[model samples]
Target chain A: MRFVLALLATLLVGTALGLAATRWTASNRQGFSAEQAGPWIAWPKAGTSEAEPYARAFQARTGYVPLGGGDGVALFALSDSDGRPLEGNCAYDVGGAVPAARFWTLEAFSPRGRPVAGPLGRLGFTSAEVMHDAAGHFMVAVSPQVRPGNWLQVATPGRFVLVLRLYETVLSASAFSLEADALPAITRGACR
Target chain B: MIFALPFFLGAVLIAVMVHLASLLALPGFATNDAYARLGRNAPIDQVAALTQAQIAALDLPFYDRSFETAVCKYDLSAGVLRLRAPSPDTMLLVTLIARGGNVYFSVSDRAAIKGLVEVLVGTDAQIEQIEASDKDDEVLGELRVRAPKPQGVALIRVFAPDETSKARAAEEAAQASCQIETL
Candidate 1:
C-alpha cells in the first residue's frame, strides 16, 4: 500500500510538471499566422468570386490567359506545350521543375474540393513516387483503366478538381505559365 | 498556529518563483526571428504581402504552435484565410483587400472578443482600439476595425470562429459588409 501511494504521488507530480513545461514552451511561439501553412496560389474555381480578381492579376502580369471558368464546376488545366489534353476520365499529367528539396503533387478532388472518390479516393504524386524517363523527365497518369506507365486510376465519372503543389521549386524552372505554349496535351484511348 | 503560518508563506513563495521562472524561460523557447519581423507597428498590408510571399515560397508549415493546452496544429485546408498569433493566442479569419484609405474585416464570434482586449494587448503593441459594433449576429461576430498607425506598414486584422470562416472570407473578400472597403 505504501509503494502504491508513492507511485501515485510520483505520477501526479510528473504530470503537473509536464503540463507546466508544455504551456511554457507553447507560450513562446509568437509570430506565425495560420494561412501561411497551406498552398498559397489557387487556380480559378468556377462560380467563385475570387476567380476574376486572380485572372485579372494573372493577365496584368502575363499577356495571355487560359480557358474555362464560370460555375458548372471548376476545371483547372495543365496541358503540354503542343495543345495536348492533360486531364481525362482516367488520369492527369503533372509537370514542373524541382530542386533537390522541391517536389510536386497532383491530387484530384470532387467539384466541392473534397476528395470523395477514386481507387484510393485520393492519389498523391510526389517526386519519390515516379518512374523518371531517360532524360530525367517524369510523367504520371490518373484514370480508372490500366496504363503502361505511372498511373493513378479514377473509378467513376464525376466533377473533379486537380491540386498541383510544387514544393521547394527552382525559381526559373517552376513553370506555372498558363499560356497555350506552356501546357501539356491530353492523351487517352476511347472507352467502350 | 505559528508553524502553519510559516508553511503557508513558504508555499506562496514557491508558487511565485515558479511563475517568474516560467515567464523568463517561455519567451526564449516561444519566439524566433519570424515573430520579430511581424511587430505591432508593421502595416497590415505589409503583413498580408509578407504572408503571400511566404505562402508562395512554401516556408509556411501546416501545423501551428499549440493552442490552449493542445499541441495539435490548426487545419488550414478546412478554410481560406487563417491567422495565428502566439503569446496572447489570437486566431482570426480576416479578409484583406486594399480600397479607399483603410482595410476591413468581418470577425467570427463577438463573444470571443470578451477576451480579445487582453489577448491582443498581451501579444501586439500595434493595436490601438477594438470596438464591438451594436449590430452583430448572435452566432457570427461583427466589428469595424481602424488601424491608422502600425510599426511599419498598415494592415487590417480579422478574427474568425474557425478555419471555415477564414476560407470563406478569402473567397468572398469583395463583398461589402458592416465593414466596407473604401478608397
Candidate 2:
C-alpha cells in the first residue's frame, strides 16, 4: 500500500509539472523566433517550417493565423512606450514612419485578442483612408472621444493592444530590429 | 513512512521526462489551433468573403478591419487543389497552412504571371506525377507547391485603403476561384 501511494503521488506530481511547464513556457517565452522592437512584438518565423516548438504551441493554443513571408510581418503592442499595459480608459497618440512596406494597417484588440469596439464601427485605420500631414507624415489618435484627424475611437472598458501589420514589407533579417524611433511611438495621454 | 532517497530521485526524473515530452507534443494535440478554428468559417474547395460579423465571431483573432479577407479549405483526397486569382488591382496575398496550422507557403500578386496568379497544391507524390506527365518544353502557368500533409487551408487577404475600395476588394476576393481537379 505504501508503494502504491508513492507511485500515485509520483504520477500526479509529474503530470501537473509537465502541464504547468508547457503553459508557462508557451505564454512567457521571448523565444528565438520572436522579435521585439520597443513595445511591438512579432514572430517572424510564424507560419513557416522553421518556427520553434514554443511559437507553434502558442499559435496552436491561441488559433492565430499569422501572416506568411510573402504577405509581410505583423507586430502587436500590449503596452505604451512607458511599458504600462494599454487600458481603454487611457488615450494614446501613435505616430511615426513605419518600416518600408507596400501596405499597412493599424488596429486595436482586447487583452483576450478580440477587436476593440468603437463608435460608428470605426475599429481601426487603413493606410488609404488616413490623412497625411505635410511631408507625408502620419499620426493617429486612439481615444474615447473623436478627434478631428485620423482617429480610431476605442472605448472598451479593459486593457487593449495595438496591432500593426506591414504587408509586403522589405525588412530583411538584419533590418527587423527596427529602432523605436523608426516605427510609431505610442505615447500615453490623460486617462479617464 | 520513511522517505527513501532513491524513490525521490526516481520521481524527479519521471517528472522531468514528462515535462519535456508534453512540451514537444502540445502542438500536435492542441484543439484550438488556427486550422481547426477555420472549420465552418469557409466552405471546402471554394472561397468566400468573411464579413465583419463573421470574422468578429470567429476564434481567429487580431483580424484587420481595414482589409477584406476570405478563406478556403482543401482536401487533396478529393483531388489536386487549384487556386486561381487575378492579379489584384492593388495588393493581394494568399497564405497556405497545413492541417496542424503550420504555414507551409505564401504568395502575393507580385508573383503573378500575365495578370493571373495560380497555384496548384498537392502532396509530393501527386506533384511528381503531375510534373512527370507534363510534356517537355510546354509551359505550365500555375505555381506548384507541395503540401507537407494531405489537408490544409488557404487564407486570402486583400488590402483596401477606403470603404469604397474595401467593397470592391471584397467582391474580387469572393470571386477568386478554388477548384479541385482529377488526378
The best candidate by TM-score is 2
| lDDT, candidate 2, B1-183, per-residue tens | 247665676677777887778777877787777778775656788887788667777757676766677888889996799998876677888888887667889899998899878999999989999999999999889999999888888888777777778788888777778988989
lDDT per residue for candidate 1 within A85-187, as digits (tens), equals 3334535444433323333444554433334235653244545556787766666666666766776665546534444543332322112223322222334
In candidate 2 the C-alpha lDDT for residue B59 amounts to 50
Best of the candidates, DockQ: 2
State the lDDT of candidate 2 residue by residue for A77-183, as single tens digits.
99998899998998899988888888788998886678776857877786777778886668999988877788888979888989998888886433466567778
What tier of docking accuracy does candidate 2 attain?
medium
For all predicted structures, in order, the TM-scores are 0.32, 0.91
Q: lDDT of candidate 1 vs native?
A: 0.32
The fraction of correct interface contacts reproduced by each prediction comes to 0.00, 0.67
By summed lDDT, the worst window of 10 consecutive residues in model 2 chain A runs over: A171-180
Model 2 gets an lDDT of 0.79
lDDT value, residue B39 of candidate 1:
29
lDDT of 1 at B136: 54
